[model samples]
Target: MSAPIQMVLFDAGGTLLGTNTDHPRWYEQFFVEACAEQGVEVTPHQVDEALVEAAREINLTHRSSSDEQVRFFWEHMYTWCFRRLLPNRDAHQLACHYIDRFEVGEYVQLFDDALEALELVRCAGLRSGIVSNFGSYLHVFLDKTGITEFFEFVIVSANEGCEKPHPEIFDLAVARAGVPAGQILFVGDNLREDYQAAERHGMFSVLVDRYDLHADKPALRRVKRLSDIAQYLPQ
Candidate 1:
């Protein structure tokens, strides 16, 4: 028989919190306006296309897990996009402007289900923690969203020098959790990085598919909201 879960581990961004301005074209519109202010005119479609191309190029060459590396990665990617859109302009300046717009406290908010899920874990006498593939600013987001106290520890990729989908990072989290991997329950939104990664390490995992994005992956355990995670835990 499977071990009873003793702790609940969560992924930060999509699982516990999300950006307040969530739209299909938020970045495309943001870049369009940033370019306009710099005496250049670019359409949202142009911005989107440029970003897609830049991201593809950067991903082939960059591996960023540290906070400084994450910053540099974005700067490089956005500068590449700006250069493609406005070849004659100071692309680095435009990239800086775009990055500054996403100031920590202003961009993210706690999910409505976040508190309820944490409370359920606490009420069930289970320990709780976080394992996120985010920069060191993960703590700042937690504090800003007023959820810092809910977790016993917060493991971030930026600080650990590794990110999810890697056994090393999961090894670190498992060690810090102080519980056998089989006795820990991990909940997150990303299927490969969060759900499958945790499962491969011998932990129970629940994919938080808030938009039903993984309906085809029915073989994997999943929930539409964090509150529904209760079904996978003790009474």
Candidate 2:
């Protein structure tokens, strides 16, 4: 008995794109290459360990931290990883290089049904956008994947000075799309961050529970495939 969906906002990482288990290896390789540029010797495994530890700490702090704080933690870790690899090089510059490479090379393939589902949404006259808690370079990743044009709006928390689970972030996306909260439908992999926040703003929400982990949550609708969204549309 809910209102029909007119707008669909998506999450970037786990929802739209999947990453391989070896994803961090790209960062390790980049660190090795950057160190080689400085005439330093380092192994990919060493850089991998440093980056992993740093990422773990960042995620730990990010659970209740601001986007800037999370960025600082990531940058610090990248700096430390670079320092470990190149004793004589500038950590900040090397971190920048490694980040650039990681952004370009570290993504997993998009789900096979993503594009078809998006097209169906468009064909049904529903607008689409992306709201992600990612770094500033997310646009580059979207463009590289050729899915950027399909989205009418892209909101990254790093650019907005806020992160998900914050009502303000969802409000910003709703405002940008020029749609009322009641008409928007947000789809994401996280139950709390995407669904609960959108619900707070009077928006409909669908949780992409690919792992079947919280199947018992009664307040929200759970979908295993992007194409399942069509069932929720107006007849």
Candidate 3:
């Protein structure tokens, strides 16, 4: 028989929290608006294209995990996107202007179901923690959202020098979880990063499908909201 889950580790951004805006393409929407603020008109599709290329460029050449490094990474990403969208404009200046406009509350929000889910974990006598591919500021973000106390630890990519789909990061999380991988339940929104990686590491995995995006994959275990996590807990 499978071991009963003793701990629950979550992915932060999409699982427990989300972008403040309701737009499905929040990243592209923000950049499209950013372009308009600079007197350039660009479609969301255009911004999405630029953003994708920028992400690829940054990932291949300039990946970093520290607080400052993370900031620098985004700045460069924005700069790349701006350069593509506004050929005649100063990309660095535009990037900095948009970056300065970010306010924590305006950028992120705790999901409606997150609190009840965490409480469920607590009431189940299961330990909870976070394993996320986030910057060093993630702890502060969690604190600002008032959910920091729920987690025993928050392992961030910036602090650990590795990110998900990579064994090293999962190793750190499993070590900190203080249980055999099979005794942990890993929940996250990403397929490869959270679900497949955790499964490969021997942890039970559940995918969070807030948008019902993966209905075609009927064989995968998933929940539409975090509150549904209770069904997976030991009864």
Candidate 4:
């Protein structure tokens, strides 16, 4: 079944690593805290709205896979976000500070079952890679979190000039993976981005509902833990 499953491609943030939920804003909480730590307090609501704005604004610009360009895109986004609360000059510098501190792995947390699933992929002789709508930060975060070695390679949207829910990144992953689309499985937490996107490309897809956040979610199949992926592999 499932073309014998030769390679596995996973989404990074929710699928393997997660933003520590010590606060309700989730990742936006970190931005709020990052600024507050600098004696610049911005409301969580402001940061959340601005974060969404930043993503939309940056995506409207042109695309590039160059690492430096990617970092600049995000830095520009940070500036856009901070400016919503601070003056132009303050916002630029604050955004810089946020990026510097954020790069140090201050908020990334790995899911409990992530490592075991990756190890099983390796042990079962399947190649593995991480494909995420992230930037170079993922490379460093994974290394500092001690899970980088498990991935044969990593494909970031910033590194590929495309993001999920679009076929560009998936096509790049397929080419880089060197496997037929049917022989690979894509795992992620988002239904549309991971499951539907990969499935649309002829690859198998699984949603890892590690927290059962979507027990009643419709039309999508999911597993409660990352390690459940082991059941899908050829034994």
Best by TM-score: 3
Order of candidate numbers by TM-score, starting with the best: 3, 1, 4, 2
What would the per-residue lDDT of candidate 4 be over residues 1-235, giving only the tens digit for each residue?
Answer: 4577989999998788876664424667777766777667888888888888888776533343556765687678888877885653587777777677666777678887888898899999989998898766788889877998888889987767788878888899999999899999899988888989999999989898766677897666789889998888889
Per-candidate clashes come to 0, 0, 1, 0
In Å, residue 75's CA in model 3 sits off its true spot by 2.0
| Candidate number that wins on lDDT, 2 or 4 | 4
TM-score of 4: 0.80
Off by over 4 Å in 1: 24-48, 60-62, 85-89
Q: How does model 1 score by TM-score?
A: 0.86
Better of 2 and 4 by TM-score: 4
Alpha carbon lDDT at 113, candidate 4: 87
In model 1, which residue pairs have backbone atoms overlapping below 3 Å? none
Report the Cα lDDT for residue 225, model 2: 83
Our tally of clashes for model 3 stands at 1
Error of 4 at 148 (Å): 2.8
lDDT of 3 by residue, 1-235 (tens): 1999999999998899876666666778888877787788899989888888887775532253556676788788889999999999989988877665553444778889999999999999999999987777677679878999999989988888888888888899889988999999999999998999999999999999988889999999999999898999987
Q: List the residue pairs that clash in candidate 4.
A: none
Give the per-residue lDDT digits (tens) of candidate 1, residues 1-235.
1999999999997889887645445567667766787788898889888988887776522244788887888898789988998899888987777676654656688888989999999999999999988778778888888999989999988898888888888899889988899999999998989999999999999999888888898787889879999999887
lDDT of every predicted structure (CA atoms): 0.84, 0.75, 0.85, 0.81
Which numbered prediction scores highest in lDDT against the true structure?
3
How accurate locally is residue 157 in candidate 2, as Cα lDDT from 0 to 100?
81
Residue-pair clashes, model 1: 0
